[model samples]
Target: EKADGIFILGQNPGTNHPRMLTTLERAKENGAKIVALNPMPESGLMHVVNPNPQEYDNILTYPVKMLLNRGTALNDLWLPVRINGDMPALRGIMKEMLAEEERSPGSVFDREFIERQTVGFEAFVEHLRATDWEDILTGSGLTRDQIRAGAQIAMHCKRIICCWAMGLTQHKNAVATIQEVMNFLLLGGHIGRPGAGPCPVRGHSNVQGDRTMGICEHMSDAFMEKLGREFNFAPPKEHGTDTVETIKHMADGRIRFFLGLGGNFLAAAPDTEYTARALQSCRLTAHVSTKLNRSHLVTGEIALILPCLGRSEIDRQESGEQFVTVEDSMGIINPSRGHLEPASKHLRSEPAIVAGLAKATLANRTTVDWNDLIANYDRIRDHIERVVPGFENFNARVRGEIFYLPNAARDKRQFNNVEGKAKFVISEMDLHKLEPGQYLMMTVRSHDQFNTTIYGLNDRYRGIYNGRRVVFMNPEDVKDAGLEQGQFVDLTSCYREEERVARHFMVAPFNIPRGCTATYFPEANVLVPINSTADRSNTPTSKSVVIRVRPSTRTAEAVNELRRNIDEVRSESASSRSPTRQS
Candidate 1:
């Protein structure tokens, strides 16, 4: 709310985080210019009401004032950039900023901050200056004038908070695109301030928290040393396999055992059919989960569906009822207390499951007392406090009313580099180049879905209702492709000459870029190639997949497949059967 300007890109906070609309409402009321950069004009960014406050089950019980709340108008400007065009869009903005800086000198650029707090400023400026406006125009699908208007809006604001999600992360040039955003922020010194700096939003708070708790492929040396000191044993320095590498190994028969802690791994992973085959190749597959999903249906030779207590379920431990601490996207550590009793009494907590797995795997050779750790969860927090930095007095501090974890980038504008100063990274604008008849297809969640979980079939913003298998394309693109409104089309993506097809997606004429289209996932996940991933992160490039859309060549197999999955999930939900291990 303290920010003068807010730049939202990639993520849809309105649908994904509806409660955030309330915060945006506060910011707008207090005078904040919210700019939305997206391929599709998201209703969440444009106009939205805080539905969380109006969680009344019955319309009859709702008050007049609450019922009439039309909601707040959010975006000052909406930039409909093409899919994978965020890099060029950012570059265009930075180029315009540099021009403005050159024309007015210090009035537009923060010279003192740039000199004192940053390096590579000169090179970054040079890169932006030399960037072709033509390339920016073609790549971003926005004119030079439009780009300048955006820069003009940004130049006036003192504090800017650039927020993004998976839409920005799941790309080939994902890291570079974020660096461009940072470069823009660094130009005006937006770091280390309230309502300013980068905000990478996650669907789940514990996704980021998992990284803090050392559930990563590559743990930092500092974290390893801290663990060694606390546990009296040196943790492995060698990096473990990431999701992509693990799947690759499994497909190649290198990895035999697949044990998932939580989440629909098969559905969430890229190349749906490939991932299924990979799991089938495995000798054993186990998932500690709260509900049954498609993952259970497609398993290895021996599969175990070990039921675990969800975050909303009360975890009665050996000592007492337990709550898990999760770190939000903004680095706020909060204790999550469960309000509901466990659906099944036999279901174990995540900690208990982990401890059991550890005991079974390591036997008597384990260093830490697994039983004691599981008995009192606070003991685990004690271990966490000892190991993780900025977590000093973890149990005491987290139990308080407010606990904000210290962030180096946000707290002091401190960069963890050789020079200990933030470096301005300059990279080439790598836009998605689609061949003729090929549209850059990006997957998105409907208003009714979260990640891989489908809530409903309607996406009111796009005007599609009671339908999950549909593609949103620009009206011009639809006409150009010889596809009419409501036409059933198949999408084909040929990666390394190996073609993958997603059959029968209805055409949804939306306000998207001319050559770009949007489809829902795990429906479109079949088109996402396993090998094509982000440059540095190795994360699947789920956002950008080059595919050609044509009239459906086959039956409604793909669409029917989704319906079957939904029916299966709903059937599983209705059943009283507790998930169990099966050989």
Candidate 2:
């Protein structure tokens, strides 16, 4: 896919995908163009070898050489759209592209690609045609013109890659939002081909791998039957539990054993107070992680913290230097072997740990060779191959260079849907709102943090330093409440009758959007209500919450004294300003 230009939109590669820098650099060296559409600035991706925009702000940067350092691009624009507003902004431009396509038949819509490859496109196109631009602009919080410019670039580009992370996926309508994104890319025929597609930047290295390797509560029938035949063991047929359901079951005392493979469960789950209680109530709590985290401290009466070999650590077994298979972003499966020795002699691999526990607890485990299964990871791969699709020859394919899973990017002619058509679900925007004087509070990860780990106190990207327990608010909101920046505030959520109340978090204020404020996750997770989640996915909408802010006073007398002094001062000022006081 030779092209005159390259566009990277709605993704931050420097912090999230650092390895992509090589491809980006090579593309620049070859005189191919690059365009970035994002809100943040001054990252490795923005400053490629050839300086594109030496002195550029809010607009297009055409021909990189003259503007900055020795660069070769003609023009690139950094279109900054509002937060949680990508859906409407993208849809508006899609409308314009449709209009252009209609004007000139068989132009660049990739008619052959759509007709031969995709299904249910007519229904999708109908939905797009019916979408009102005014409603889109209002919901997206972007001007029609700005979105139109982005659309134009997408339509014109030959090879384009659109990527997004939690910023786009952790929303109430995230599924639909991402679906629309795919729709836009597919409309331009940019996906399923080399050098072009939709990429969801997963947070963890093996999150997708875990899902592919049968780590889900909801297992397909085909996969289950394959597992029964291949392993000769009857796996639990009924769906078990997801993160949310697991919490509910634990709280209700139905699930006594909480066995986590490798995750900061307490820190990752929603509603910190209830999650802590649920974890504490478990009869046997087990955490398999490389390092000790907050979950170890928030353990039950009988708890086991089993350390494990990190991805970078050597997985020594009878079979010599062992490697674990991890599926990275873009569906490429590679064997990840630890180069360093184990942190502790007591450490074990995740699969080994799971097998050991299962053997110890289950009586029917006599039929399975848990030790052999653990010693040779290929056995695990064989089981995976038999159980999961796209892994027909898991051992052979895995032994080679990283290979992609089937039906994810390629084989677009048929979809997983029974009708072989990608369904376009109809949805209406229902933005969360709070009462007057209440602002929408969202949780975000600091630049210095990874998942729940606090690497440092400074968030250089957001202009914060030496502090991780601070909140960002609009300057006007601070002034309206008689508060100043850097002032301490108590964040509180509303109570519903006899239901459990959320914890109040103490935070310092900084400058952000007027009606929108943000706090770091886990610490800020206490503010997120448990029932408040997305419609379809049931994913906790950790990004958005409605809360009230009160001035945090260390002493009750201090608050009382301030109130008393203010009342006295108001009385005196009124007496002086007016004819007389009401004494």
TM-score of each: 0.94, 0.83
Q: Candidate 2: worst 10 consecutive residues by lDDT?
A: 574-583
Q: Going through the candidates in order, what is the number of backbone clashes in each?
A: 0, 9
Q: Which structure among the candidates has the greatest TM-score?
A: 1
Residue-level lDDT tens digits of model 1 in 1-583: 6899999889888667776887887899899998888988888888866555455456554454358856679989888888878888888988888877888899888888899889999988888889988899988998777788789888999999999998899998999899888998999998887778898887576365888888899988988888888987878878999999999999999999999887889999999999999999999999988777789888899999998887777778889988888888888888987777777788888889999999999887768899999998999999888888878998888788768888887887788889989899989888667789988888988776666777666678668876678898899989888889877888898677889998778888999988888889887898899999999999899998888898986556756766775676555434423333210
The per-residue C-alpha lDDT of model 2 at residue 92 equals 75
Q: Stretches of candidate 1 above 4 Å error?
A: 52-69, 555-583
- In candidate 1, position 328 carries an lDDT of 85
lDDT of 2 by residue, 359-475 (tens): 988757557888888888888788777778788898888788888888654545456667664444445554444577777666776655556666555567667765555667766
RMSD list, candidates in order:
3.3, 11.5
- In model 2, residue pairs whose N, Cα or C atoms come closer than 3 Å (at least 3 residues apart or on different chains), thus clashing, are 61-75, 61-76, 62-74, 62-75, 63-73, 63-74, 63-75, 64-73, 313-338
